[model samples]
Target chain A: MVILFPSKPSILACGAVAGPVERKSVFYSFFDSVIEDERWGQKTNEQGHSQMIQEACDILMKKAEINNLDVDFFLSGDLVNQMTPTNFAARELAISFIGLFSACATSISSVIIASLLTELGASELAIAGASSQHNAIERQFRYPIDYGAQKPATSQWTVTAAGYALVGKHNPEYPSIIAGTVGKVVDYGEVSPFHMGGAMAPAAYDTITSHLKKRHQKITDYDLIMTGDLGKIGLKILKAMFAQSGAKQEELDVLRDAGAEFYGDDKAFQAGASGAGCSASVFFSYIEQQLKIGRYKKVLLVATGALLSPMSFQQGETIPCTAHAIEITME
Target chain B: MDPQEYQQLEQQMTPPTPYLKNVLKAFFVGGIICTIGQAITYLYVIFFNFTEQTAGNATVATMVFIAMILTGLGLYRKLGQFAGAGSAVPVTGFGNAVISAAIEGRTEGFVLGVGSNMFKLAGSVILFGVASAFFVALIKLILVSVGVLEW
Candidate 1:
């Protein structure tokens, strides 16, 4: 469903923190901080995941010049089991917490909810975003990190990062969220857990197309439409689907994927970076910075997620995917 | 599009697995591992009072011990990635699998975690190995009774 925000909730500040490996990311400089240790000095990967989220939220609050007491709600999620990392973070932040799970799409989904709260005049300031830890998430969803299982080229590397945006009353000087689309679960019968992008591409296409049709806007209306983590092959599949639908070449040029281009053609990353933090970090830091500086006047941030658990995949169930999109425009 | 049509399209779009390259890697890596085992066997025969038959057990144990060290040091996984089935098909791979599972389950604690999960990946190998060994021994016994084979 497309939800129009007449109040135009503004992203007052954004904070993105990533792990040591993320220094190689193309948008590394845009991140607020890159922790040298993946575990952030924590005893376990999950604790480290929580630490990263806390650090990101701290940075966001610092940037916004607000304390935890000033914030009304904390909306967040992660790919870990029960989103325990985010839940732990919320406990530390001492904010009214609403834990969400749209898989990787939690980044945009959380923001959409924050915007709704802002529009309803129920929230003066809210922290919204998502996070993912490579070791923690990989161990949960795939194999143990030390397992020597050879992954296919379609596989994506989960990033250890957290991105949070402080959402508040509209300010013309900031990038304001004007609308959002809460995606329906779309399944194209994709079964391979290794090829997440292929499974999520169809859902992304569905959400974007529906958003455009319902909003009565053309593809060219936005400066960019970036999907969350449809890796190299998934982006190609999405483009192919669009091309077959008779989309013009120039119109398709605006399409981009945070996952496909994250590592800048590094073969070691295979299809590219993924995880809940993949889009969160990119959107809250790089994308938000671009909008604030007028580099991009309007853009659609579509975070797609493959909604399959380890049990579901093991039971021979196809991946059901979803994409949540928020349209950000600078005055 | 329908699921079948989309699946077909997805198949067309997805790249084919590089079988030739992977097979070549697997072959060389597997060969090197076997070469190392042979060297270890020779060392056992020369330095100790072990016969060739006795050295086989020592060599297997030594290989598994080395693999356990590599697994603890977090180096075997990288080798496994590079060598594919080469690292996995060997006895070293079995050791690595067991140790990795043990390490991964450490977060949950010792008895329930490490003890229960230590054999998660390698338990099948042991079960099938013993079962097949028993069946083969049974077949030989049957043939010997019929005077078709000698024990």
Candidate 2:
């Protein structure tokens, strides 16, 4: 018999990791960049940053009692080639599985897969998780900073962390995957491929509307409605864009996150955070943490991933992206 | 499976290494990858006589190509084991991801398969570079036009 539940069994053991960074630094700079069209050089990596993700994932998996084998499948990803950490680790552990997902929203996307698998009797136990290592993000996506490049304010800081939740029937109330809405590609030729994510808030706005349409719930009904780290600009644009959809950000005190903002001061940054892990760890850690605090009832997690193509860029394919939304009830 | 076997499997599945060791392993492996980066930096300077900025720009494209090949040979996951972030943190890392994804997609179509989807994300990175450079050029032009900032 298959059962479904929160990734955490005891409900006490949910985890998320966001590096320390303040929000204001990212917020102010993000707006400045968008308006001023500021130029942010790439962010380079410093020492001791890469391990932050590996450590976080290893710890959370251990806490959840998710053995590599017990996990029927290892559905995870990274901003690296072949999803190195997750892929290599899964290989070493010999956990044969499939990996499918949408960028920052991977965590939620996978959780949805795990839930349906568990619910549909395909598997009893499974691990649905995703990680983002800041080091790799910096090196791959932007400059490592050791190169001493100044960043424009709208740039997103990559967060180095991994968040995981074991999905199964551990608790009755904390249903791991309740319901979710899948996002569609929304592109306006005005947004550049590199700037595709700028319109990501619209993607989020689109998914949230889909979820609302599906569930028939008011925006205020959910205890929290968290979007994947749109960073500052993405979030603000997301909030503003929702106006067209009749969802007002001012009305909802829903927890907003740009996990990159956790990096705090001493770092020149913008927007908020912009990484797959930024949302993964932040959502996992925050939802789990707040579940304990007894503050939230329902949570909406909408994660956005940018889909861009080089051939498209050469041929000039405007960035075409898709997002997925997952709703979990800590009932 | 027997209880003993199940427990054994669990133990084996779990990272037998201590947390700190795993963390340090990631750090060192990542560091080794960065060392490659440093070497590349040196190459950029000595051979091309390019400024660090040009060198940095070139590094992204170069590393991405290397990552794509490594991903094809199925060596990246191993490197990822030794250096989690070190492997994933560079432009090459993302290249590896997109290329591998497209490679997997190849199972569906050979002619229009992975090759077609091959550069799913390369556009964004290239766009990021080009757009930022254009914006920077515009800013520099404005600055040059005024007397506040110099090129």
Q: Please give the range of 10 consecutive residues that has the lowest summed lDDT in model 1 chain A.
A: A143-152
* Candidate 2 residue lDDT tens string, A185-227: 7654423432334646556766777777667778888877887
Residue-by-residue lDDT tens digits, candidate 2, B1-151: 2334423432332223355655676678667766777789889999999887779878777877777677777677556545555566665567666776576544347667557655554557777989999999999999988987876
Best by DockQ: 1
Once model 2 is optimally superposed onto the true structure by TM-score, how far is the C-alpha of residue A202 displaced, in angstroms?
A: 1.4
Q: Which runs in model 1 stand beyond 4 Å of their true positions? A: B134-151
Expressed as tens digits, the lDDT of each residue in B36-83 for candidate 1 is: 999999999999978999999999999999998998888998898788
* Cα error, candidate 2, residue B96 (Å): 25
> What are the RMSDs of all candidates, in order?
1.6, 18.3
In candidate 1 the C-alpha lDDT for residue B149 amounts to 93
How do the residues A85-198 of candidate 1 rate in per-residue lDDT, one tens digit apiece?
999999999999999999999999999999999999999999999999999998889877887877889999999888999999999999999999999999999999999999
For candidate 2, the docking band is: incorrect
